[model samples]
Target: MTQDKLIRRVLKPVVWVLCLGPLGGLAWLAYSGGLTANPIEFLNRYLGEWALKFVIFALAITPLRGLTGWAGLTRFRRLLGLFAFFYVVLHLSSYVGLDQYFDWNAIWLDITKRTYITVGMVAAVILLALAVTSTKGMIKRIGGKNWNRLHKLVYLAAAAGCLHFFMMRKGVQLEPLMYGGAVLLLLGYRLVGYLKKRRRKSRLAVA
Candidate 1:
C-alpha cells in the first residue's frame, strides 16, 4: 500500500483504538470494582490525566512532523486534539455528576474558592473553544490568519492544565513536575521555531 493508504487504513485505526484504551480500562476497573475505596476520585483523576496526556501528544505533533519531515503527521493532529477535548469533557463530567452529584451551588463554590479547580476550568474552556472551531468550515468562516491566532491559545491551555495538575496534588509530586517540564520543553521548541521564522522573514524583507 502507498504511505497514504497505509496511514488511512492501518495507522489511523490503531491510533484511534489506542486513544480509547484509557477509557476502556477505566470502565473495566469500575465494573470490576477495582477503583479502590475512592472510586469517584479515582475516576476523575484518571480521566483528567489522560486529557492532559492527549493535549501534550497533540502539541508534540507539530514539532515531531517538522523534525522528521513526515507531513502525514498533521493528519492526526486534529484527531488527537479532539480526543483531548473528549477526555477533558469526561473528566469534568465525572467531577460534576459523580463527585459533586451535580450540586451546582457547591460546584460554583468550588470553582470560585479552589485555585486548582479554577485553573482547570480555564483550561477546559480554552480546549472547548479550540474544539468548536477546529472544523474546515470554521476555519473558512474565520479566515486562516484569525484561526491561527485563535488556535495559539492551545499553549495557554496546556500551561494552565499543567499548573492545575501541579496544584491539585498535595505538597510536591514528581508526576506533575514531569508533565509540566514536558510542556515547558514543547513551548520552548515552538518559541524557538517562531523566532527562527521571524528572523528568516526579516532577512528576506531586507534582501
Candidate 2:
C-alpha cells in the first residue's frame, strides 16, 4: 500500500485507542481496587488529567502537522477536540454529581465563592461553545476567519484550566508544574509563529 493509504488505515484504530484507552485503563484500575480509598478524588483527578491531556493533544496538532508533514492529521483534530470536551464533562460531572452529591445550592455557592472553580467553569463554558460549533454547518455560517478567532479561545481556556489545576493543589506539586509547562510550550510556539509572520509581512511591505 502507498504511504497515504497506510496512514489512513492505521488512523482509525489509533484514534479509537487514543480516545477510549484511558477509560478502559480507569475501569481496569477500578476493578483491581487501584483507586485510592477516596474514590471520588481518584475519579476527579483521573478525569481532569485526561481532559487536560486531550487539550494538549488538540493544541499539538498544528505543530505536529508542520513538523511531520502529515497534513491529514488535521482531519482528526475535530474528533480530538470533542474528546477533550467529553473528558471535561466527565470531570465536571464527577465533581458536581459525585463530590457534591448533586447539591445544586452548594454547587452554585462553590462556583460563586471559589476563584479556581469559577475559572474552571469559565473554561468549561468556552470548551462547550467550541464543541457546539465544531460542525461544518456552523463553520459555514460563522465563516472560517470568525471561527478561527473564536476558537483561539482555546488558548485562554487552557490557561484558565492550568491555573485551576495549580490552585487546586495544596502545594507546588510536579504534576501541575508539568501541565503548566506543556501549556506554556504550546502557547510559546504559537507566539513565535505569530512574530515570524509579522516580520515576514513587514519585509514584504518594505519591498
Number of the top-ranking candidate, with lDDT as the measure = 1
lDDT values for all models: 0.96, 0.92
Per-residue error at 167 for model 2, in Å?
Answer: 0.3
Rate residue 89 of model 1 by lDDT: 99
Each candidate structure's TM-score, on Cα atoms with residue i matched to residue i, is 0.94, 0.95
Question: Residue by residue across 1-207, what tens digits does model 1's lDDT show?
Answer: 999999999999999999999978988998999999998899999999999999999999999998999999999999999999999999999999999999999999999999999999999999999999999999999999999999999999999999999999999999999999999999999999999999999999999
Error of 1 at 179 (Å): 0.7
Q: How would you encode candidate 2's per-residue C-alpha lDDT over 4-88 as one tens digit per residue?
A: 7765688756896879989999999999999989999999999998998899899999888988998888878888889999999
**What root-mean-square deviation over C-alphas does model 2 reach?**
1.5
RMSD of each: 1.4, 1.5
List of clashing residue pairs for candidate 2: none
Q: Which stretches of candidate 2 lie over 4 Å from their true place?
A: 1-10
The superposed Cα distance between candidate 2 and the true structure at residue 163, in angstroms, equals 0.6
Off by over 4 Å in 1: 31-33
